[model samples]
Target: MVRPLYPINAPTYLRLRDQIRADIEGGCWRLGQHLTLNELSAHYSVSNVPVREALLQLQGDGMVDMRMNRGAVVLDVNERFIDEYFDIREALQSMLMTRACQRRGGGVLMQAKVLLGRVDEAMREGKVRQLLEADHALQDAIGHMGDNEPAMAMLASRSRLLEAFRRARLDLLTADLMQLPVQGLAMLLAIEHGDPGSGCEAVRRHVAAMRAYMKKLLKIPEGRSRADASLVNVPTFTRARESTAAMPEASSTEPASPAVASPGPPTVLPLSLPPGRRLDPEGDGSNDNRSTDDGLHPPKR
Candidate 1:
Protein backbone atom coordinates (compact mmCIF):
# COMPACT_ATOMS: atom_id res chain seq x y z
CA MET A 1 0.00 0.00 0.00
CA VAL A 2 1.24 3.52 -0.91
CA ARG A 3 1.39 6.22 1.82
CA PRO A 4 -0.22 9.60 1.32
CA LEU A 5 2.17 12.57 1.38
CA TYR A 6 0.70 15.40 3.40
CA PRO A 7 2.12 18.90 3.99
CA ILE A 8 4.70 19.15 6.75
CA ASN A 9 3.47 22.18 8.72
CA ALA A 10 0.05 23.31 7.51
CA PRO A 11 -3.23 21.48 8.07
CA THR A 12 -4.14 18.96 5.35
CA TYR A 13 -7.65 20.31 4.94
CA LEU A 14 -6.47 23.87 4.36
CA ARG A 15 -3.89 22.73 1.85
CA LEU A 16 -6.50 20.70 0.03
CA ARG A 17 -8.87 23.65 0.08
CA ASP A 18 -6.25 25.90 -1.53
CA GLN A 19 -5.40 23.37 -4.18
CA ILE A 20 -9.06 22.85 -5.04
CA ARG A 21 -9.67 26.59 -5.13
CA ALA A 22 -6.66 27.10 -7.38
CA ASP A 23 -7.88 24.40 -9.76
CA ILE A 24 -11.28 26.02 -9.92
CA GLU A 25 -9.79 29.44 -10.71
CA GLY A 26 -7.27 28.04 -13.17
CA GLY A 27 -10.16 26.75 -15.28
CA CYS A 28 -9.41 23.10 -14.60
CA TRP A 29 -13.01 22.67 -13.42
CA ARG A 30 -15.66 24.39 -15.47
CA LEU A 31 -18.67 26.12 -14.01
CA GLY A 32 -21.29 23.70 -12.62
CA GLN A 33 -18.80 20.84 -12.78
CA HIS A 34 -19.29 18.42 -9.93
CA LEU A 35 -16.39 17.62 -7.58
CA THR A 36 -16.77 14.19 -6.05
CA LEU A 37 -15.10 13.11 -2.82
CA ASN A 38 -14.13 9.70 -4.19
CA GLU A 39 -12.39 11.16 -7.26
CA LEU A 40 -10.64 13.86 -5.21
CA SER A 41 -9.50 11.28 -2.65
CA ALA A 42 -7.99 9.11 -5.38
CA HIS A 43 -6.45 12.15 -7.11
CA TYR A 44 -4.73 13.53 -3.99
CA SER A 45 -4.12 10.10 -2.47
CA VAL A 46 -5.83 11.33 0.71
CA SER A 47 -8.75 9.80 2.59
CA ASN A 48 -12.33 11.03 2.27
CA VAL A 49 -12.25 13.03 5.53
CA PRO A 50 -9.81 15.74 4.36
CA VAL A 51 -11.45 15.93 0.94
CA ARG A 52 -14.88 16.47 2.52
CA GLU A 53 -13.49 19.11 4.88
CA ALA A 54 -11.80 20.93 1.98
CA LEU A 55 -15.00 20.89 -0.10
CA LEU A 56 -16.98 22.25 2.86
CA GLN A 57 -14.47 25.06 3.29
CA LEU A 58 -14.64 25.84 -0.43
CA GLN A 59 -18.43 25.96 -0.23
CA GLY A 60 -18.10 28.59 2.52
CA ASP A 61 -15.77 30.57 0.24
CA GLY A 62 -18.47 30.59 -2.49
CA MET A 63 -16.18 28.74 -4.84
CA VAL A 64 -18.35 25.61 -4.68
CA ASP A 65 -22.00 24.85 -4.03
CA MET A 66 -23.15 21.86 -1.93
CA ARG A 67 -26.46 20.41 -3.03
CA MET A 68 -28.78 17.58 -2.00
CA ASN A 69 -28.08 15.27 -4.96
CA ARG A 70 -24.94 16.86 -6.38
CA GLY A 71 -21.73 16.59 -4.34
CA ALA A 72 -19.91 19.90 -5.04
CA VAL A 73 -20.42 22.14 -8.07
CA VAL A 74 -18.13 24.97 -9.14
CA LEU A 75 -19.86 28.28 -8.60
CA ASP A 76 -20.46 30.66 -11.49
CA VAL A 77 -18.43 33.87 -11.39
CA ASN A 78 -20.96 36.23 -12.88
CA GLU A 79 -20.49 39.80 -14.01
CA ARG A 80 -22.11 41.26 -10.91
CA PHE A 81 -19.84 39.21 -8.69
CA ILE A 82 -16.74 40.51 -10.45
CA ASP A 83 -17.93 44.09 -10.08
CA GLU A 84 -18.58 43.69 -6.37
CA TYR A 85 -15.22 42.04 -5.82
CA PHE A 86 -13.41 44.90 -7.52
CA ASP A 87 -15.46 47.43 -5.58
CA ILE A 88 -14.23 45.98 -2.31
CA ARG A 89 -10.68 45.91 -3.65
CA GLU A 90 -10.82 49.58 -4.70
CA ALA A 91 -12.04 50.77 -1.30
CA LEU A 92 -9.50 48.80 0.69
CA GLN A 93 -6.66 49.76 -1.68
CA SER A 94 -7.59 53.44 -1.43
CA MET A 95 -7.52 53.24 2.35
CA LEU A 96 -4.15 51.51 2.18
CA MET A 97 -2.72 54.21 -0.10
CA THR A 98 -3.90 56.97 2.21
CA ARG A 99 -2.38 55.28 5.25
CA ALA A 100 0.79 54.35 3.40
CA CYS A 101 1.29 57.96 2.42
CA GLN A 102 0.85 58.96 6.06
CA ARG A 103 3.33 56.35 7.34
CA ARG A 104 5.86 56.10 4.49
CA GLY A 105 9.51 56.14 5.59
CA GLY A 106 12.85 56.13 3.77
CA GLY A 107 12.95 52.36 3.68
CA VAL A 108 9.54 52.21 2.07
CA LEU A 109 10.58 54.69 -0.60
CA MET A 110 13.72 52.70 -1.38
CA GLN A 111 11.81 49.45 -1.59
CA ALA A 112 9.19 51.02 -3.89
CA LYS A 113 11.87 52.33 -6.25
CA VAL A 114 13.52 48.92 -6.36
CA LEU A 115 10.22 47.24 -7.13
CA LEU A 116 9.46 49.75 -9.85
CA GLY A 117 12.84 49.06 -11.39
CA ARG A 118 11.96 45.40 -11.47
CA VAL A 119 8.65 46.25 -13.16
CA ASP A 120 10.50 48.29 -15.77
CA GLU A 121 12.86 45.40 -16.41
CA ALA A 122 9.98 42.99 -16.80
CA MET A 123 8.18 45.30 -19.21
CA ARG A 124 11.26 45.64 -21.36
CA GLU A 125 11.45 41.87 -21.65
CA GLY A 126 7.74 41.54 -22.53
CA LYS A 127 7.29 39.04 -19.71
CA VAL A 128 3.71 39.48 -18.55
CA ARG A 129 3.91 37.15 -15.54
CA GLN A 130 7.08 38.78 -14.26
CA LEU A 131 5.55 42.22 -14.68
CA LEU A 132 2.44 41.20 -12.77
CA GLU A 133 4.45 39.61 -9.99
CA ALA A 134 6.68 42.67 -9.65
CA ASP A 135 3.69 45.02 -9.61
CA HIS A 136 1.97 42.85 -7.00
CA ALA A 137 5.06 42.98 -4.81
CA LEU A 138 5.19 46.75 -5.17
CA GLN A 139 1.56 47.08 -4.06
CA ASP A 140 2.16 44.69 -1.16
CA ALA A 141 5.13 46.78 -0.03
CA ILE A 142 3.02 49.93 -0.09
CA GLY A 143 0.22 48.20 1.84
CA HIS A 144 2.74 47.16 4.49
CA MET A 145 3.89 50.77 4.79
CA GLY A 146 0.55 51.60 6.45
CA ASP A 147 1.17 49.07 9.26
CA ASN A 148 -2.56 48.32 9.41
CA GLU A 149 -3.09 44.67 10.23
CA PRO A 150 -6.87 44.51 9.74
CA ALA A 151 -6.78 46.20 6.36
CA MET A 152 -4.01 43.89 5.18
CA ALA A 153 -5.95 40.88 6.43
CA MET A 154 -9.04 41.96 4.50
CA LEU A 155 -7.00 42.44 1.33
CA ALA A 156 -5.22 39.09 1.83
CA SER A 157 -8.48 37.15 2.21
CA ARG A 158 -9.24 37.56 -1.49
CA SER A 159 -5.65 37.62 -2.72
CA ARG A 160 -5.51 34.00 -3.86
CA LEU A 161 -8.65 34.35 -5.95
CA LEU A 162 -7.35 37.58 -7.42
CA GLU A 163 -4.03 35.99 -8.38
CA ALA A 164 -5.76 32.96 -9.87
CA PHE A 165 -7.96 35.09 -12.09
CA ARG A 166 -4.99 37.10 -13.26
CA ARG A 167 -2.98 33.95 -13.92
CA ALA A 168 -5.77 32.53 -16.06
CA ARG A 169 -5.96 35.73 -18.10
CA LEU A 170 -2.29 36.36 -18.78
CA ASP A 171 -2.83 36.53 -22.55
CA LEU A 172 -5.46 39.23 -22.21
CA LEU A 173 -3.11 41.46 -20.20
CA THR A 174 -0.24 41.64 -22.68
CA ALA A 175 -1.68 44.66 -24.46
CA ASP A 176 -2.07 46.62 -21.23
CA LEU A 177 1.33 45.72 -19.81
CA MET A 178 2.84 48.89 -21.25
CA GLN A 179 0.68 51.11 -19.07
CA LEU A 180 1.14 49.09 -15.90
CA PRO A 181 4.63 50.33 -15.10
CA VAL A 182 3.71 53.92 -15.88
CA GLN A 183 0.80 53.75 -13.46
CA GLY A 184 3.03 52.15 -10.84
CA LEU A 185 5.61 54.92 -11.26
CA ALA A 186 2.94 57.55 -10.77
CA MET A 187 1.84 55.95 -7.47
CA LEU A 188 5.44 55.67 -6.30
CA LEU A 189 6.08 59.33 -7.00
CA ALA A 190 2.95 60.33 -5.14
CA ILE A 191 3.98 58.25 -2.10
CA GLU A 192 7.57 59.47 -2.22
CA HIS A 193 6.44 63.12 -2.23
CA GLY A 194 4.02 62.56 0.67
CA ASP A 195 1.00 63.47 -1.42
CA PRO A 196 -1.86 61.37 -0.09
CA GLY A 197 -4.40 62.92 -2.43
CA SER A 198 -2.42 61.95 -5.50
CA GLY A 199 -1.74 58.53 -4.08
CA CYS A 200 -5.44 57.85 -3.51
CA GLU A 201 -6.35 59.26 -6.91
CA ALA A 202 -3.72 57.06 -8.50
CA VAL A 203 -5.16 54.03 -6.76
CA ARG A 204 -8.67 54.90 -7.93
CA ARG A 205 -7.51 55.48 -11.49
CA HIS A 206 -5.55 52.23 -11.57
CA VAL A 207 -8.47 50.18 -10.28
CA ALA A 208 -10.93 51.88 -12.61
CA ALA A 209 -8.72 51.29 -15.61
CA MET A 210 -8.27 47.64 -14.73
CA ARG A 211 -11.98 47.14 -14.16
CA ALA A 212 -12.85 48.81 -17.44
CA TYR A 213 -10.33 46.74 -19.37
CA MET A 214 -11.41 43.48 -17.78
CA LYS A 215 -15.08 44.25 -18.39
CA LYS A 216 -14.35 45.03 -22.02
CA LEU A 217 -12.46 41.78 -22.43
CA LEU A 218 -15.20 39.78 -20.77
CA LYS A 219 -17.94 41.55 -22.78
CA ILE A 220 -19.69 42.60 -19.58
CA PRO A 221 -21.87 45.69 -19.61
CA GLU A 222 -20.74 48.69 -17.57
CA GLY A 223 -23.53 48.73 -15.04
CA ARG A 224 -22.97 51.99 -13.14
CA SER A 225 -21.51 55.43 -13.47
CA ARG A 226 -18.57 56.71 -11.42
CA ALA A 227 -20.84 59.12 -9.56
CA ASP A 228 -23.07 56.25 -8.45
CA ALA A 229 -20.27 53.86 -7.57
CA SER A 230 -20.12 52.66 -3.98
CA LEU A 231 -16.59 53.70 -3.20
CA VAL A 232 -15.05 54.86 0.07
CA ASN A 233 -14.14 58.52 0.34
CA VAL A 234 -10.64 58.40 1.77
CA PRO A 235 -9.78 61.71 3.42
CA THR A 236 -6.65 63.31 2.08
CA PHE A 237 -3.88 64.54 4.37
CA THR A 238 -3.51 68.31 4.75
CA ARG A 239 -0.48 69.99 3.22
CA ALA A 240 2.42 70.69 5.55
CA ARG A 241 2.21 74.45 5.01
CA GLU A 242 -1.50 74.53 5.75
CA SER A 243 -1.09 72.54 8.98
CA THR A 244 1.86 74.69 10.12
CA ALA A 245 -0.04 77.90 9.42
CA ALA A 246 -2.97 76.73 11.49
CA MET A 247 -0.83 76.56 14.66
CA PRO A 248 -0.51 79.64 16.91
CA GLU A 249 2.91 81.34 16.93
CA ALA A 250 5.24 80.43 19.83
CA SER A 251 5.98 83.29 22.27
CA SER A 252 9.76 83.94 22.32
CA THR A 253 12.07 86.60 23.79
CA GLU A 254 14.93 85.91 21.34
CA PRO A 255 15.55 88.30 18.42
CA ALA A 256 13.99 87.32 15.05
CA SER A 257 16.38 86.22 12.30
CA PRO A 258 16.08 87.08 8.59
CA ALA A 259 13.85 84.73 6.57
CA VAL A 260 15.68 82.25 4.34
CA ALA A 261 14.25 81.44 0.92
CA SER A 262 12.58 78.03 0.49
CA PRO A 263 13.54 75.88 -2.48
CA GLY A 264 11.15 75.25 -5.40
CA PRO A 265 9.23 71.99 -5.89
CA PRO A 266 11.35 69.06 -6.96
CA THR A 267 11.34 68.36 -10.70
CA VAL A 268 9.27 65.30 -11.66
CA LEU A 269 10.17 63.04 -14.58
CA PRO A 270 7.56 62.89 -17.32
CA LEU A 271 6.44 59.28 -17.75
CA SER A 272 3.38 59.65 -19.95
CA LEU A 273 2.78 57.61 -23.08
CA PRO A 274 3.26 59.61 -26.25
CA PRO A 275 0.24 61.20 -27.86
CA GLY A 276 -1.31 59.14 -30.73
CA ARG A 277 1.10 56.30 -30.04
CA ARG A 278 -0.80 53.23 -28.93
CA LEU A 279 0.86 50.66 -26.73
CA ASP A 280 2.26 47.97 -28.98
CA PRO A 281 2.58 44.60 -27.27
CA GLU A 282 4.89 43.66 -30.09
CA GLY A 283 7.90 45.97 -30.14
CA ASP A 284 8.35 48.39 -33.02
CA GLY A 285 12.06 48.59 -32.19
CA SER A 286 12.23 52.20 -33.40
CA ASN A 287 12.66 54.33 -30.25
CA ASP A 288 14.76 52.12 -28.05
CA ASN A 289 17.39 54.79 -27.24
CA ARG A 290 15.07 57.76 -26.94
CA SER A 291 15.05 59.72 -23.66
CA THR A 292 12.21 61.98 -22.45
CA ASP A 293 12.67 65.65 -21.60
CA ASP A 294 13.08 64.89 -17.89
CA GLY A 295 16.18 62.75 -18.59
CA LEU A 296 14.37 59.48 -17.97
CA HIS A 297 14.83 57.00 -20.80
CA PRO A 298 12.47 54.27 -21.97
CA PRO A 299 13.20 50.74 -20.84
CA LYS A 300 15.78 49.05 -23.08
CA ARG A 301 15.96 45.38 -23.94
Candidate 2:
Protein backbone atom coordinates (compact mmCIF):
# COMPACT_ATOMS: atom_id res chain seq x y z
CA MET A 1 0.00 0.00 0.00
CA VAL A 2 2.96 2.34 -0.58
CA ARG A 3 2.85 4.92 -3.34
CA PRO A 4 5.50 4.97 -6.07
CA LEU A 5 8.03 7.78 -5.90
CA TYR A 6 6.99 8.73 -9.41
CA PRO A 7 3.38 7.62 -9.41
CA ILE A 8 1.79 6.90 -12.75
CA ASN A 9 -1.99 6.91 -13.10
CA ALA A 10 -2.19 3.26 -14.05
CA PRO A 11 -4.05 0.01 -13.45
CA THR A 12 -3.21 -2.57 -10.79
CA TYR A 13 -1.46 -4.79 -13.34
CA LEU A 14 0.88 -2.04 -14.56
CA ARG A 15 1.76 -0.87 -11.06
CA LEU A 16 2.33 -4.49 -10.09
CA ARG A 17 4.60 -4.82 -13.09
CA ASP A 18 6.71 -1.91 -11.84
CA GLN A 19 7.06 -3.50 -8.39
CA ILE A 20 8.02 -6.85 -9.89
CA ARG A 21 10.57 -5.14 -12.09
CA ALA A 22 11.91 -3.11 -9.18
CA ASP A 23 12.32 -6.35 -7.24
CA ILE A 24 14.08 -8.01 -10.12
CA GLU A 25 16.49 -5.15 -10.79
CA GLY A 26 17.07 -4.60 -7.11
CA GLY A 27 18.11 -8.30 -7.01
CA CYS A 28 15.11 -9.31 -4.94
CA TRP A 29 13.74 -11.36 -7.85
CA ARG A 30 16.50 -13.85 -8.54
CA LEU A 31 17.43 -15.42 -11.84
CA GLY A 32 15.53 -18.63 -12.71
CA GLN A 33 12.94 -17.90 -10.04
CA HIS A 34 9.37 -18.71 -10.99
CA LEU A 35 6.80 -15.92 -10.77
CA THR A 36 3.40 -17.45 -10.72
CA LEU A 37 0.31 -15.38 -11.35
CA ASN A 38 -1.42 -16.59 -8.18
CA GLU A 39 1.65 -15.75 -6.06
CA LEU A 40 2.10 -12.26 -7.48
CA SER A 41 -1.59 -11.52 -7.20
CA ALA A 42 -1.60 -12.60 -3.57
CA HIS A 43 1.43 -10.48 -2.76
CA TYR A 44 0.11 -7.33 -4.43
CA SER A 45 -3.52 -7.87 -3.35
CA VAL A 46 -4.70 -7.95 -6.94
CA SER A 47 -6.57 -10.50 -9.09
CA ASN A 48 -4.80 -13.17 -11.14
CA VAL A 49 -5.89 -11.50 -14.35
CA PRO A 50 -3.84 -8.40 -13.64
CA VAL A 51 -0.83 -10.43 -12.55
CA ARG A 52 -0.98 -12.33 -15.84
CA GLU A 53 -1.12 -9.03 -17.69
CA ALA A 54 1.95 -7.75 -15.84
CA LEU A 55 4.00 -10.88 -16.55
CA LEU A 56 3.04 -10.66 -20.19
CA GLN A 57 4.42 -7.14 -20.26
CA LEU A 58 7.68 -8.22 -18.60
CA GLN A 59 8.04 -10.99 -21.18
CA GLY A 60 8.41 -8.39 -23.91
CA ASP A 61 11.24 -6.67 -22.01
CA GLY A 62 13.32 -9.90 -22.03
CA MET A 63 13.07 -10.05 -18.26
CA VAL A 64 10.63 -12.97 -18.07
CA ASP A 65 10.42 -16.37 -19.69
CA MET A 66 7.22 -18.36 -20.02
CA ARG A 67 8.55 -21.91 -19.90
CA MET A 68 6.46 -25.06 -20.19
CA ASN A 69 7.34 -26.29 -16.70
CA ARG A 70 8.43 -23.09 -15.03
CA GLY A 71 5.46 -20.91 -16.06
CA ALA A 72 6.58 -17.27 -15.83
CA VAL A 73 10.17 -17.08 -14.68
CA VAL A 74 12.87 -14.43 -14.54
CA LEU A 75 15.39 -14.93 -17.36
CA ASP A 76 19.13 -14.89 -16.77
CA VAL A 77 20.57 -12.21 -19.02
CA ASN A 78 24.02 -12.63 -20.51
CA GLU A 79 26.61 -10.29 -22.03
CA ARG A 80 25.30 -10.34 -25.60
CA PHE A 81 21.93 -9.04 -24.49
CA ILE A 82 23.63 -6.22 -22.61
CA ASP A 83 25.79 -5.49 -25.63
CA GLU A 84 22.78 -5.31 -27.91
CA TYR A 85 20.92 -2.99 -25.56
CA PHE A 86 23.86 -0.61 -25.39
CA ASP A 87 24.41 -0.85 -29.13
CA ILE A 88 20.88 0.22 -29.81
CA ARG A 89 21.10 2.87 -27.13
CA GLU A 90 24.24 4.23 -28.74
CA ALA A 91 22.59 4.48 -32.13
CA LEU A 92 19.52 6.15 -30.72
CA GLN A 93 21.56 8.62 -28.71
CA SER A 94 23.67 9.39 -31.77
CA MET A 95 20.54 10.22 -33.71
CA LEU A 96 19.80 12.86 -31.11
CA MET A 97 23.31 14.32 -31.00
CA THR A 98 23.02 17.04 -33.62
CA ARG A 99 19.70 18.21 -32.30
CA ALA A 100 20.96 18.27 -28.75
CA CYS A 101 23.88 20.43 -29.75
CA GLN A 102 21.68 22.82 -31.64
CA ARG A 103 19.18 23.11 -28.79
CA ARG A 104 21.47 23.30 -25.78
CA GLY A 105 23.56 26.45 -25.68
CA GLY A 106 22.13 28.42 -22.73
CA GLY A 107 19.47 27.42 -20.20
CA VAL A 108 18.80 23.86 -21.38
CA LEU A 109 22.12 22.36 -20.25
CA MET A 110 21.43 23.78 -16.81
CA GLN A 111 18.36 21.57 -16.57
CA ALA A 112 20.63 18.57 -16.96
CA LYS A 113 22.94 20.04 -14.32
CA VAL A 114 20.17 20.22 -11.75
CA LEU A 115 19.22 16.60 -12.41
CA LEU A 116 22.84 15.58 -12.04
CA GLY A 117 22.95 17.44 -8.75
CA ARG A 118 19.90 15.47 -7.65
CA VAL A 119 21.83 12.30 -8.44
CA ASP A 120 24.53 13.42 -6.01
CA GLU A 121 21.93 14.47 -3.48
CA ALA A 122 20.10 11.14 -3.72
CA MET A 123 23.32 9.20 -3.38
CA ARG A 124 24.64 11.32 -0.50
CA GLU A 125 21.36 10.99 1.38
CA GLY A 126 21.15 7.20 0.83
CA LYS A 127 18.06 7.39 -1.34
CA VAL A 128 19.31 4.96 -4.00
CA ARG A 129 15.92 4.17 -5.55
CA GLN A 130 15.37 7.86 -6.00
CA LEU A 131 18.82 8.03 -7.61
CA LEU A 132 17.80 5.48 -10.26
CA GLU A 133 14.68 7.50 -11.05
CA ALA A 134 16.80 10.65 -11.18
CA ASP A 135 19.21 9.03 -13.62
CA HIS A 136 16.36 8.36 -16.06
CA ALA A 137 15.04 11.88 -15.70
CA LEU A 138 18.46 13.35 -16.40
CA GLN A 139 18.96 11.25 -19.53
CA ASP A 140 15.46 12.04 -20.75
CA ALA A 141 16.24 15.74 -20.52
CA ILE A 142 19.39 15.20 -22.57
CA GLY A 143 17.32 13.28 -25.13
CA HIS A 144 14.75 16.04 -25.19
CA MET A 145 17.39 18.55 -26.26
CA GLY A 146 17.87 16.42 -29.39
CA ASP A 147 14.20 16.49 -30.51
CA ASN A 148 13.80 12.90 -31.67
CA GLU A 149 10.55 11.50 -30.37
CA PRO A 150 10.92 7.94 -31.67
CA ALA A 151 14.36 7.36 -30.14
CA MET A 152 13.18 8.97 -26.93
CA ALA A 153 10.23 6.61 -26.86
CA MET A 154 12.49 3.58 -27.11
CA LEU A 155 14.79 4.96 -24.39
CA ALA A 156 11.77 5.52 -22.18
CA SER A 157 10.69 1.88 -22.51
CA ARG A 158 14.06 0.59 -21.39
CA SER A 159 14.80 3.24 -18.79
CA ARG A 160 13.91 1.13 -15.76
CA LEU A 161 15.74 -1.89 -17.13
CA LEU A 162 18.79 0.22 -17.90
CA GLU A 163 18.79 1.46 -14.34
CA ALA A 164 18.72 -2.16 -13.18
CA PHE A 165 21.61 -3.09 -15.42
CA ARG A 166 23.48 -0.10 -14.05
CA ARG A 167 22.88 -1.04 -10.42
CA ALA A 168 23.90 -4.64 -11.03
CA ARG A 169 27.02 -3.37 -12.75
CA LEU A 170 27.85 -1.08 -9.84
CA ASP A 171 27.57 -3.95 -7.38
CA LEU A 172 30.36 -5.68 -9.28
CA LEU A 173 32.20 -2.47 -10.15
CA THR A 174 34.80 -0.57 -8.17
CA ALA A 175 34.41 2.75 -9.96
CA ASP A 176 31.43 5.04 -9.52
CA LEU A 177 28.45 5.44 -11.86
CA MET A 178 30.05 8.75 -12.84
CA GLN A 179 30.41 7.39 -16.38
CA LEU A 180 26.86 8.59 -16.91
CA PRO A 181 27.34 12.24 -16.05
CA VAL A 182 30.83 12.24 -17.48
CA GLN A 183 29.86 10.96 -20.89
CA GLY A 184 26.62 12.87 -20.70
CA LEU A 185 28.56 16.04 -20.11
CA ALA A 186 30.97 15.17 -22.90
CA MET A 187 28.08 14.65 -25.29
CA LEU A 188 26.52 17.93 -24.22
CA LEU A 189 29.82 19.72 -24.69
CA ALA A 190 30.25 18.23 -28.12
CA ILE A 191 26.73 19.33 -28.95
CA GLU A 192 27.42 22.83 -27.70
CA HIS A 193 30.47 22.98 -29.92
CA GLY A 194 28.25 22.02 -32.88
CA ASP A 195 30.07 18.79 -33.57
CA PRO A 196 27.68 15.89 -34.01
CA GLY A 197 30.43 13.46 -34.91
CA SER A 198 32.24 14.15 -31.66
CA GLY A 199 29.01 13.87 -29.72
CA CYS A 200 28.26 10.52 -31.37
CA GLU A 201 31.75 9.34 -30.59
CA ALA A 202 31.31 10.29 -26.96
CA VAL A 203 28.11 8.24 -26.90
CA ARG A 204 29.98 5.34 -28.46
CA ARG A 205 32.67 5.47 -25.80
CA HIS A 206 30.07 5.81 -23.09
CA VAL A 207 28.27 2.65 -24.17
CA ALA A 208 31.51 0.81 -24.81
CA ALA A 209 32.74 1.54 -21.27
CA MET A 210 29.55 0.19 -19.76
CA ARG A 211 29.65 -2.86 -22.02
CA ALA A 212 33.26 -3.49 -21.06
CA TYR A 213 32.36 -3.31 -17.40
CA MET A 214 29.45 -5.68 -17.88
CA LYS A 215 31.73 -8.14 -19.66
CA LYS A 216 34.22 -7.95 -16.85
CA LEU A 217 31.54 -8.47 -14.22
CA LEU A 218 29.95 -11.37 -16.09
CA LYS A 219 33.46 -12.84 -16.57
CA ILE A 220 32.74 -13.19 -20.24
CA PRO A 221 35.85 -13.95 -22.28
CA GLU A 222 37.76 -11.23 -24.10
CA GLY A 223 37.26 -12.14 -27.78
CA ARG A 224 34.02 -12.55 -29.72
CA SER A 225 33.33 -16.22 -30.50
CA ARG A 226 33.29 -17.33 -34.14
CA ALA A 227 29.56 -17.79 -33.82
CA ASP A 228 27.29 -16.17 -31.27
CA ALA A 229 26.81 -18.81 -28.57
CA SER A 230 23.43 -17.34 -27.75
CA LEU A 231 21.83 -18.29 -31.08
CA VAL A 232 22.86 -21.96 -30.96
CA ASN A 233 20.49 -23.00 -28.20
CA VAL A 234 18.38 -19.92 -28.05
CA PRO A 235 15.60 -20.09 -25.54
CA THR A 236 12.52 -19.09 -27.45
CA PHE A 237 12.20 -15.41 -26.61
CA THR A 238 8.51 -14.71 -27.13
CA ARG A 239 7.73 -12.46 -30.06
CA ALA A 240 8.07 -9.01 -28.48
CA ARG A 241 4.44 -8.25 -28.00
CA GLU A 242 3.37 -4.71 -27.26
CA SER A 243 3.04 -3.96 -23.56
CA THR A 244 -0.46 -3.37 -22.16
CA ALA A 245 0.63 -0.66 -19.74
CA ALA A 246 3.46 1.83 -20.00
CA MET A 247 5.05 4.26 -17.56
CA PRO A 248 4.32 7.77 -18.67
CA GLU A 249 7.53 9.31 -20.01
CA ALA A 250 9.27 11.73 -17.60
CA SER A 251 10.10 15.14 -19.10
CA SER A 252 11.00 18.76 -18.23
CA THR A 253 10.26 22.21 -19.67
CA GLU A 254 10.80 25.26 -17.53
CA PRO A 255 11.15 29.02 -17.70
CA ALA A 256 14.11 29.38 -15.32
CA SER A 257 17.51 27.67 -15.46
CA PRO A 258 20.48 26.95 -13.19
CA ALA A 259 24.18 26.80 -14.09
CA VAL A 260 25.57 23.57 -15.57
CA ALA A 261 28.14 21.74 -13.45
CA SER A 262 31.38 20.28 -14.75
CA PRO A 263 31.89 16.55 -14.39
CA GLY A 264 34.80 15.42 -12.19
CA PRO A 265 36.24 12.19 -10.82
CA PRO A 266 33.45 9.97 -9.52
CA THR A 267 32.87 9.33 -5.86
CA VAL A 268 32.24 5.74 -4.78
CA LEU A 269 28.62 4.54 -4.74
CA PRO A 270 26.74 1.91 -2.72
CA LEU A 271 26.55 -1.49 -4.36
CA SER A 272 22.78 -1.85 -4.74
CA LEU A 273 19.60 0.19 -4.81
CA PRO A 274 17.51 -0.51 -1.75
CA PRO A 275 14.00 -1.91 -2.11
CA GLY A 276 11.51 0.90 -2.54
CA ARG A 277 9.45 1.64 0.53
CA ARG A 278 6.18 3.19 -0.51
CA LEU A 279 5.56 6.79 0.49
CA ASP A 280 2.54 7.30 2.68
CA PRO A 281 -0.11 8.20 0.12
CA GLU A 282 -2.31 9.86 2.75
CA GLY A 283 0.60 11.98 3.92
CA ASP A 284 2.87 14.19 1.80
CA GLY A 285 6.15 12.27 1.21
CA SER A 286 7.83 14.36 3.94
CA ASN A 287 8.44 17.91 5.13
CA ASP A 288 12.20 17.54 4.77
CA ASN A 289 14.56 20.31 3.64
CA ARG A 290 15.10 18.92 0.12
CA SER A 291 12.91 20.43 -2.60
CA THR A 292 9.80 18.61 -3.88
CA ASP A 293 9.97 15.72 -6.39
CA ASP A 294 9.50 18.13 -9.30
CA GLY A 295 12.84 17.10 -10.79
CA LEU A 296 11.84 13.44 -10.45
CA HIS A 297 8.20 13.48 -11.56
CA PRO A 298 7.19 11.39 -14.59
CA PRO A 299 6.33 13.62 -17.54
CA LYS A 300 2.66 14.61 -17.74
CA ARG A 301 0.73 13.95 -20.93
- On lDDT, the leading prediction is 1
lDDT of 1 by residue, 1-301 (tens): 1123566987889888877876766667665578788888888899988988898887776667786645687765556766887798789888888877776633677767777777766554444456667777877777888778788767765555544454444223333445566667767767777778878777776666656545543542322212211111112312222433453443377433422325653223343444544332222224333343211244455
What TM-score, computed on C-alpha atoms, does each candidate reach? 0.65, 0.58
Q: Tell me how far the alpha carbon of residue 201 in candidate 2 is from the true structure, in angstroms, after superposition.
A: 1.0
lDDT by residue for model 2 (1-301), tens: 1235645566877778878888977767766588777777777888888888788888876678876544598876567777777788888978887778776534567667667667655443333345546656766777788877888867765545544554443232112233444455556567567778767777776666656655555653222221111111112211111110121222346322322335775333221222452222111223222333222222255
Cα lDDT of all candidates, in order?
0.60, 0.57
Model 2: lDDT of residue 192: 60
Candidate 2 error regions (>4 Å): 1-10, 68-70, 105-107, 114-138, 165-182, 220-301
Against the hidden true structure, what lDDT does model 1 obtain?
Answer: 0.60
**Count of clashes in candidate 2:** 1
Against the true structure, candidate 2 reaches a TM-score of: 0.58
Q: What is the C-alpha RMSD of each candidate to the true structure, in Å?
A: 20.3, 18.8
**Where does model 1 exceed 4 Å of error?**
1-10, 25-27, 173-176, 219-301
